[model samples]
Target: MPELKGVDGLSEPLLRLYSSLAGENPWVEFLTVLRRQLHASFATIILTPPTARTPAIVVTPGVPDFEIGAAVKHFSKDPFVGLPEGRVLTANEFVGREAYRQSCFYQQYVASYGIEDIMGLDLLAKSGFQMRMRICCGAGRSGFTEEDKQWLGYFVPHLRAALDLYERFEIEKGEENIYDTAVEQLSVGSILLDGSGAVIRCNLIARNLLEQRDGIRLVNNRLAFSDTANERSFRDFLRASGPALTSRISFMQAERHSGKPSLGIIARRLTMPPSLKLGFCPAIAVFITDPQQQAGVTGAAVANVLRLTPMEAEIAASLANGLSLLQISEVFGITQNTVRAHLRSVFSKVGVSRQSQLVQRVRTSVSGLIVQMSSGSGAPRRRSRQGAPLLHSAGAGQDRPQVKQTRRLSHVP
Candidate 1:
């Protein structure tokens, strides 16, 4: 048999192992190499990203098969014995040494596996993240030498580069899958606008919500939000939320519905491909809420979002459609002061101060959701009319208030 030359010479064995480890995770190939080269009673490889403390094991192929690729989380937290200064551990340095002899938890396991020594090569990324890749040897009386250290030092860089490439590839793959899933699951109309505020990507929900507007369509590989006043504001918010800017901009409903607070949140960075960094002006991820999906929208579906007393939500819904306190009182058969008091409480509970404020707060709370109401259809569709002192209807039976239309954008991603 040809002698294995550290990691490089074991390529043939690794190819065979890769077939078995192949699954959702692609990091398994490197671990298979470590398993073949170590010739140990057991062996494994770990890859830990900077954002996480938990080390994800990529491969484990031998006697201690159960421990294969098991995440060595809480390694840093172990006060019993810090990792030895050197990469490799000889029988004397491990089984015969003070740290191993003194460690109650780790010693017994090493003995049971018949593992006499270990060599842990710290795989470091060009990104300056330290990763752990370890090999154990139980070959009787034979141990790792300085020659092995030199071989690992030469092989480490190649492993690091390969791992880095694989990770980036995996991230791109995962992001693509997630984006597709988001497109399928979300109910809110989403127009992925570019830096110029043109729509770059739109799903069925967005197409349905935006009424198939042409201005928002792609023109010469760019999307425009249909030069409207609201479109301008949406573009402005997107710019503020972009990575080039530092301002903490938020997206909220342009109008509030009755009894519900407008949904708004700060947009954060979305994951993108490395290719985009060179010249790709990526679209920002902004959330829009759909009121119909809200928990407090007067029905069981919205009971949670509004967090209102059932009676209070009813009153607020009445007030939202430009209803006067007297009209509401007549309809509910309550006094005007009592209705006003309830309105005040409704505003406070829903995080609004006045009727106009209440309406403003919920406009962005739910997207593509016109309050499931018939009364607002006749009221002049006044887009800019800020405040209309609610007029009371003459008869109690005829007093129905218009419904508020709040926009909701959900973060399905």
Candidate 2:
């Protein structure tokens, strides 16, 4: 541990700070710790400036959040705009003590939130990236003293380094996400099974398919089929035998009240390398592809692109699949009014005015690309939910020309 000589109660916060980059609510834990230590109203991060298209991302735990801290972005009249970069400054230091108290911004905006004083730092990275962090005092909390400023200064270098590391992580993660992005676009239902043939994880496509309760659905978190013989074979394939094997089941999941059941499924036993063999990892992957699903738009496809809520994405995808408003309502078991309301939200977010325009937007999206039918069962499958490599399906002796093993499972009563 580096010497935190001047700063008191900083060791815990700093530990949380560096560890929070990958967490769901990154930095919230650190901010909470720091807020208590500093005896402040809030420790907030202004992640981005609010824009016409999207709202600013604010992280101020235990507050109205975007309303108070994000006010820095919306409020036009701001006297604290020009803080020295990478340096901590108090509100009193920004403007004269008397001027800051008398400023219209404080009276009109700051006072309403019960915030009495603010110690802020603006960090600008080499990539022209910027974020502001403020340690604020509310009513009855004593204003920041000189010791506070000195203590905060101790964190600047560490914070900058953490931010740099965070940016690099995001870049690397973005590159890795291309595989998932492609799978989501293809809309292939993928499920991962363990050594005992129990479902461990599934992608959004699998979730949606399982929801339909078609020929292939989940039974107690494991893959299930309408025919007993197919189910037995699928279970057998999921069990790890001496040699890793792959199989394909055709029309295994027959859609009830549908024109034709053309779902093609591929199951492969996986072999983990000696290094990656740790833990109770998934041992099988079942890749399900429905021509009807792959040929049309799936809700999972556009969810990331539009940043749409799951419901909105579903509604949009349904519309893109040539389903009318009534059809969407009927399929989802919701009222037409509710369906229209969600459609309107989608329209607003996507900048479209009409249903036709919305459908056109979904159809034109890269996610709308049709996934072609693979030549046979041995064809590769896409990535599963946050998994190991899917393309590296070949087990031991991967370079050898293994015999083309195929199991064409047909539905038998």
Candidate 3:
């Protein structure tokens, strides 16, 4: 191998390629851009495992259309795949040393894959991470020059950023899809409202529920759920629950005009997943209403879902109904200071910031559990169902306190 020169000629195109990849999918754009710029026969993007032995091509496009999975499977045989993991196996080094290089892995697996000389860029994610990215460009009629490698290398970092964004977008999109499916499968009418109380998203059930009458029609920027005290309560709940740390509030009303007799409001805060705490995305507030089946988990049900102590569950249920600290304290016949202390413990155990966040988390978690149950995956859990006593001896609504018999319903004897 000769001494590699600086990337003087390729800098301009490389910069343009980088700019194009920003806020866009890298692999698709790379194949399209490289085909015209590098004039390559084929281009592929491969993801290599930590060991760098298995190069799974996540995306491939360009000339010499190949079997996507099989092409990547074959490339895993090449020892050069490990180069990104700090193992440098160059073409010059492998060609003369390894006899297998004589028969290209692609040729052995799929003849006429038409890969002659290849230029690759080794890409790794965050520092100290084990994943690798390989960009392979094959020579159709004529082989690649050293210049092609320098050009591709110049654009590799930009492509890597785009790939990372694309992967995240896909993940969030998939999660949203699952959420939508869950909402649709159930009889619950679910709606997710933004901080401003605008409907960001609502399922089919919510649509039918709200659109049946003109009472809750979507005006320019507001929702008119009802004309009486129900609308005012809904507004109050949304305002209080919008920024709650470990609490949520929700509203439900029977379609009186539609001949159903259900009307209620519940509010709770949403919890950010521990994994997503690294970013600054806003916490979500979920709203759901139903006339037939009551909305929200019963006190016993929520206690089971969160594995909360009976006292904690009572506090949570109170907060979920949009009760202030003073209100909750009065309701439970406890001092305000005691209510504050209990809430702190609730936030810590449930992993949320304020009351609103907690309520949102509880609703989302319970809804998810219900969805899983409907799919035959499992059942909703309650503290009482967890072989724990349902109530404390000192709290309101106390019962005769004997050692309650317990049974484990999760795994039967």
Candidate 4:
């Protein structure tokens, strides 16, 4: 890195350089200006090398991409590439001018376009980030001078920083999208509330639940329940000051239609570090679970981990959700004896001798956290021939067990 006399007249191009990170074509404006300032024929940059599914993204500012002929395309690798990092080297300087002129790579690819002089800046990051920029000129024009090299050299560090920041943001954004999609697949509605009880963030599931207005909704941007008593309790929870001594979990049911079950909500306060409390930090997170929509434990997921037949896996998953042996039989249209037989097999394979042990094992299994995305909402529910959810308790419409029977059936029986 060499020091310049001064960065006079660099404000405009430097501004464009950093600002380009947020633009659709990040390097177009800066590269276009670089070409103009240097009086070059073309300014090109390669961000991502070609892959099996995507062609290399090669950007040539002010130059429309047309066929450069088969000969040029066939010369895929640049012979003048691999220049010393951070050093601006022209093609003539990189290789002997005579050798550069005689090389088939230049004669076939570059000469066809009347390009005589070429200057390149390459960044090879240890983190596998690669960027290369080239400025080309015609034979009639003077080659890139020391001043031109120094000007580009000044931009090297800033270009690297801007590119690094851009890549970091893209990776984080991609991770966020993946997490949100997983939440949607699990069918859990999430809502975030700030310290003042204002809505900070709400996912699509939460939005749909609020839109229904069956039991709870957004009232002036704050959560509200249909029942006045329940509303007061929620308001109290929101207004409570100071952090809890220990992590705590609270549950509340928002009553829905007359015959329908209430929406189950689990509220937990988020404890932020003292340093992060300056901003509008989310103080509470509310998760809504609809048992009617709960298909989180799928048979395929269970079978993969438990190594059981699909039917046995389904029975295990049902029992894990607090289903009695009788209810499991009714759900699968199998006899109680057959259901108990499957339960015994599940216990044996799961290394559990008792029915309750098998239930707990399945409940805590990896399958419990997995969901089969069969349909739009990704919740694949089991329905009886009567078009009713087999897992739900009729009339009661609660998330509790369908029957009050004991979990254990003796092996002798």
Candidate 5:
């Protein structure tokens, strides 16, 4: 391995590649820039290991899609695959010029693409994963020189480091996606705003509420209440909740839409370490709650809390939604008589006489249970009334007498 010399000219392009890798630039653009720097007709980086089912990543610029497809189809037979790991080799090293011109790989794949000679550097191989870089020249052009190979060799370590950094960045982005999804499922709408009151991040629920434009909306990327006075006050509250301040403010904004309750907005300044504050983190978090929005109750809560069977829980959940016995039977594909029987059993267990009483009881008891269940076990599995069998314990005979008094019922008469 010769010392890489006269490489000062390559510094700018190399730095651009590193910066692009650090940001959100596409890999193909980086490869295109790299190919121009190498003065090659085409450039590619491949990660293919013997034990791997497929290539992990393939970046090729200035290569036709058909040629790439053909290359993939015949990759096992390519002479480059036989090269020693982490070594630089030219096409002529594997075959003489005459033999190369007569080879099947050259005629079927390389020739069709007008590629005559290839110079490849096997940059790294670890745990059965090999990473390689290749530069190719067109037909009738001179092959890659020893200087070119040495120049690429010098940058192999930096390329490996950049790739490792990219992988870590991808992992962190995936974790951020998980966090965003979890927050979106929250019952309360959450919005993160900068010091200037511009929205930095918001969950799906917040987006939906903004779309409704009933009480609040996004104006010029900032949260705005329907009322001008409320909007002005909200903006001032956000400005006060800056990084230098630790304050909490709560306000109620009346809904412009009829029959909807006013929304409760709570803004709290986020406390962060000095280092984190320097990273442009949001200064305030706003939680919005709409009292008119119906709360979701999972059937699993009814089963676990009320000690009902899965089928009974399904019927009880439907009843809690103010569904008529006939409607519940239609929805579950069961007879109305069967629905009535299930309803009677549910009323006995829940200590509720009238349908309204049952609905109120279930709603009040299970409203807060959704947050706990979603946070702990996620949404409950919905059971099919037709497919799920009614479960009865042998001890039911003893517990039936105390069914109405077993649990302290809520909103039951």
Candidate 6:
């Protein structure tokens, strides 16, 4: 790569671009700064090539939305198509100035947009994905020179690396969203905690549980039990489950107000996946199950898993929640006989005979096993029907466990 004079001026903008691509700032702002640094009238970064099926992602700051739309719609007419990848090409190289002025592409698209001189560099192309950077000078400005091309060449590698990093970051974000959505759909409340017992990330159910303050709640962004004794024990348990050392899964019971059933909590240590080592993912996954709350599973999941009708799935879900025939009838606004008829069909499809059997089967089959309360100890026990326990034992409690720890163990600051 040819070194450009006064390259120090590009350092700040390059750093900003890297940060923006990493998702810290807006990407358009970086593009605007980049266009100014190159002294171009307009600049664009296209992620996808102009094709019939896939729409290209053209990022051009300081350009009107209507012009952007027009450019994308007529992108196939772009003069830079089929150019050598990773090589900078000037408009004049493709066609003589007089010939280009008379071409349909120039008359219909380029002239209307006031674009006079164009220069583009293909940044990357792999598989079906392609990315390119283009800079255009208006009618008033002169065409890009050899010095301009050399300056852009010096930063091509940096732009490529930044784009790759941004792509990975987007993929990770998408995966995180899917994981969060799945967890939120479950009947169980999921809370992700860091090494310091502080709440890192949580789903909708967990947020609702915290807001309700039934048994567990958030105190200064840290997980806290309503009961002082239970809170102390829980804090100690979290402290012992640091990332440096692997610890056994722990179970704790939170006492609720009134005569309602106590909340069941199952905590297990989780190691950050190698791909997410640079992000803030919790080291501990805590599942909370309230006995008073009904088992809620999506009707679609039940239908797909058991191959039952929509009505049958709804009836089965009601049965799984320990609802009686009369209660199901009242809830569905149907007669008791109609309820029994649906129940029979549900039982036949689910391979169960009695209501108790149907409840047990649906509870275990559709939503996995429930956390049953242990007889001797008040702690909740995770019992999977497949004989694979969801959580391990917490081992013996320590007399004096350290509480304070780092918020993020593996994340890059």
Task: Return the top candidate by lDDT.
Answer: 4
Estimate, for each residue in 1-413, the C-alpha lDDT of model 2 and write its tens digit. Answer: 22354334778878889888776666678778777878887787654311112213456676543354345444456577568998889887888667876888777667777877888888865554456787878878667887888878888998888767755554444323433444556667767676777888877887897787777778787778866777776766655355324333333444443455656777655655456444566666677777776556666556645557789988998888788889899999999999989988998999999989998888766333322212122212233244321221112122211222111111100
lDDT of 3 by residue, 1-413 (tens): 22234342344445444554433444455455565566655455554322223332344443333344454445545544445432323343444323434556533642344445445555555421123433333434445565555555655556666545543443344334444434443356555554556666667766776677534556554566656766776667655632234444344553356556654434444555556534543233444455565454444445656767777877887677577888888888999998888888889999998888988877777677644532324342112323422222111123211111111110000
Angstrom error at residue 138, model 2: 3.9
Query: What RMSD, rounded to one decimal, does every model reach?
Result: 17.7, 14.6, 16.8, 16.2, 16.2, 12.7
Determine the backbone clash count of candidate 4. 0
CA error at residue 328 for candidate 4, angstroms? 23
Q: Which run of 10 residues does model 3 get worst, by summed lDDT? A: 404-413
Q: Write the per-residue lDDT of candidate 5 for residues 223-309, one digit (tens) a residue.
A: 878887888787677656343456455566646665577887777666556676556667667777777666454455566556677
Candidate 1 regions exceeding 4 Å error are: 1-25, 62-98, 126-128, 187-413
Runs of candidate 5 exceeding 4 Å displacement:
1-8, 22-24, 47-52, 63-68, 82-87, 94-104, 124-130, 184-190, 201-205, 226-257, 261-413
Comparison by lDDT, 4 against 5, better one: 4
What are the lDDT scores of the predictions, listed in order? 0.45, 0.63, 0.50, 0.65, 0.61, 0.61
Candidate 5: 10-residue stretch with minimal lDDT = 404-413
Which regions in candidate 4 have their CA more than 4 angstroms from the true location? 1-8, 12-45, 48-75, 95-117, 136-141, 193-197, 219-222, 241-250, 270-284, 296-413
Q: Ranking by TM-score, best first?
A: 6, 4, 5, 2, 3, 1
The best candidate in terms of TM-score: 6
User: 1 or 3: which has the higher lDDT?
Assistant: 3
Question: Stretches of candidate 6 above 4 Å error?
Answer: 1-8, 24-26, 49-52, 64-68, 95-99, 125-128, 241-247, 272-281, 291-413
In Å, residue 266's CA in model 1 sits off its true spot by 27
- For candidate 6, write residues 30-53 as lDDT tens digits: 667667776777777766421213
After TM-score superposition, what is the CA distance of residue 388 in candidate 6 from its true location, in Å?
33
